[model samples]
Target: MSDSSPLPPVRLHPEAELARDALSTPLLSRAARLARWAGPDTRVDAGGGLVDEQLPAAAELLGLTGDAAAAHAAEAWRVAVDTGLVEVTDEEAGTVAAGEDLPLLTGGSPHDILAVWLAALEAVLADATVPDLDDLAEAMDESGEIDFSRLDWDPESEAAFLDGVLGNLYLLTVTEDGPGDGPVPLPALAASMIVPGDLGEPTNDMLEQISDAMMRLDDQFRLLEPIGLVAYQPVDEALMGDPEEEPAAPLDETDVSRYGMVRLTPLGLYGLRARLLEAGFGAPAVGDLVDKGADALLDGSSGYGPLAARAETQQWLDRREPLAAARELLAAARGSDEGAPLRRLRCQQALSLVGAQAEPAVRDVLDDPELGGLARVWLSELGAADVPPPSADLVYWLTIDTLAAQLAAEGNSEELQTLLEGLAQQHSGFFAAAWRVGHPATADVLEAMGRLHPDKRIAKEARKAAFKARSQQGG
Candidate 1:
């Protein structure tokens, strides 16, 4: 149907609306009933407005096997207690007994179940309430890679939520699974989960739109950037409106959400549902999602710090904007030339945020080797361009001394290689470090470096170390 096709009316109340407002206006209802029942807040005797008598069949509806269903119900009950989304009171006589399952009914079809999950997630996100990690895991696992074809949502809504859930779940899982070194970075996890086929049979245009939206999400929220790299919930200010105030629906017709939103306009829902019915839309391959994420990050944010700069840069990159982050950094640095070292540092940082792309400019700042140690070091770490190998032999000797001392603790040949590779691509000096470590005295020594390099060079040197290790083992 055309975008302006006649729509079904909003059907909140069949009683009053029968004679009033145009009945043709399509009404998109929610899946809260199903979500409430299936969510962690539902227990056998309490929460989710469920009665004890409903337990047995509810378990069956959930498709839980035997005692597993009971267990699931109980866990939901416990979750209810913990999150305070619901409450349980002692029975004063025979009003209701503990351990009894409430009879809950839902018009929820498969798509409805999916819709409910998306709605819940959106609620939690908007409220900044962290989702119950375990509950989501169960849902995703049970759903098993997800097939929107069988789901009950409008096609657009389905695609939007699928993308959103994938993004969020990927981030949450990564945070928990990541090495406990720093604030959980969604990018790393997003990078891992995103791979081919994750978009199912998405068209190139759809992918581009999603990419652009993700980049925007990244710029607004750094922690969420990597997740955006895969999936995202684009805020439809018109649809979602201001949570604290305003009517239940949006007033603006022009405003549309790029990412999936729990609430959708009639047209949006219509489009989504229609797409769901259309053939070819399938489960996106995890590998493809990951690759997309990696490509975005690699090309988007070169390398600065605070991590937020990368996030912002990613936004522009996603749009395929001509003003790439590298040029942006250069402009910033050139503008701040007369400022304090702090300003220079900030500009450098901005450049660094652009990563390897800004290396040349970074190297240009180090004409005076005496004051360039720190700058050169940063360039080296990021694999930036070089400053002509320190023209003076004495300076070269000092540079080598400093480098050797700094790297004295032993290094992974492969990890060093990767690190130097980034730099070597820009400045040949970093490659030297990788080469030096590649020929370390022994396999065990190189292995030790791979295992213990404190500077995070292991990723860079791991391969070279492996090669050297095999060579040594053979000899």
Candidate 2:
């Protein structure tokens, strides 16, 4: 697939796209490069894929490490196979590289490779056998020296039980965290598998069974870790039965989430996104614009919250010339919409980013009573021709609106406090007069200022102004 592959119908928040750019794309690129370096026949015998042999070379290329513990060759191979940059084929006895595998000689789109990786994950799961789980479970049982209860799920075939672990692993891994950055703790992952989702509370027996199963299920990691699909950081070994060693206590839910915070690797994040979308969960895109017009971009952004709106709008603005952006923004502000006042306010703020060239269009709006306050402020900020002072109510509304814009745009608490101090200095009875300002947002703006101001005295004054405005409205 190419970048032209249709994404989910709904546009997601910008953060989702940003995470992939910052994490996933880079990981895929590195994996592609590493795979090519490892060559076409990158064969892996039952002895863990011959990954260790290539570690020094791959590590040098990726800048990870060539040394035994630091080597990430295993992880590189996992990424390569998952991303389809490197192909792993079945041999008569073990796994071998497919002869026709084409290396991703150049960088491919993250979205394209992510789809391939996800398809592969589903394919492997659909075809995986019970023997796969049994081989891992046997190894885990030998290490289970701690007290644990076997699960009541008695399957005549251990294969079914093994498959359950894999299913539980996949489900738990997907639900664990967002843009999951850390590896998950095996105990926590195992406990989630045992915890009945329908039960309001599980019994103590279930908890014990889950704990033991989690330890036994450590075999999941034992199998997956070698392929570099997962990794672990053991906190401490249970120094049980040794008088000199402190006794290790059973892990509780709090200890489980606290001690071992498992995160997915970038590769895992890529694969899991596919799983999430398949489950009908909405995956976010950073800057998928529904419309490119200034109004559409500005209006479209409001639903995404402040940071996203700013990011979304800035991205839209960056693509167009400043003069064009200013004109479109001004026209969007003049739309016959339900939220005209708010739109006008937002438009003026966006114009500031377009700079002085926007002054003439902004000046033309000064005659409109609703936008008069904002236009005057825009002119002043640009140091244009001298403008007569606005009326006291207009002044009150304009100052409050300006502060509100700052609160939304700049978010400077100190600047807000300073503005309040200036109002106090300029007008001895600022709050008393502010209570009766003639703008629609007067009360709301004052109320927000009061609620958000850090200074107790200023916040009190703002609250007083808001109360008076409310009383006036009621009367």
**Which is the leading candidate under lDDT?**
2
Model 2 lDDT tens row, 111-166: 54345445444433332322333444554555664212433233344444444554
Alpha carbon deviation, residue 237, candidate 1 (Å): 52
**Taking the tens digit of each residue's C-alpha lDDT, what string does model 1 give over 1-475?**
1223221111121212321211121110112122344443333332333456655555565455665565444333333333333334443222222221111113324343233223323332332222233534544535465443443335454344444543333223222232212232323222323334465555666555555444433333322221111223444444334556876554654433322322232222222333333433321111212223323333222222224333443443444423254444433333211122222334444455456655655555565433344356667778654444543433433333333322432234454445434433454343234333322233433444445445465434744654555564565
User: What's the lDDT of the predicted structure labeled candidate 2?
Assistant: 0.55
- Which ranges in model 1 have alpha carbons more than 4 Å from their true place? 1-53, 60-68, 89-364, 370-389, 393-398, 401-475
- Clashing residue pairs in candidate 2 (N, C-alpha, C atoms within 3 angstroms): 14-286, 44-49, 182-262, 182-263, 183-262, 183-263, 184-262, 184-263
Q: What TM-score do all the candidates reach, one by one?
A: 0.26, 0.51
Cα RMSD to native, each candidate? Answer: 21.5, 10.6
The lDDT for every candidate, in the order shown, is: 0.36, 0.55
What are the runs in model 2 whose C-alpha is more than 4 Å off? 1-75, 88-103, 107-291, 299-315, 321-324, 334-346, 386-389, 406-414, 448-465, 471-475
Backbone clashes in each candidate structure, one number apiece? 59, 8
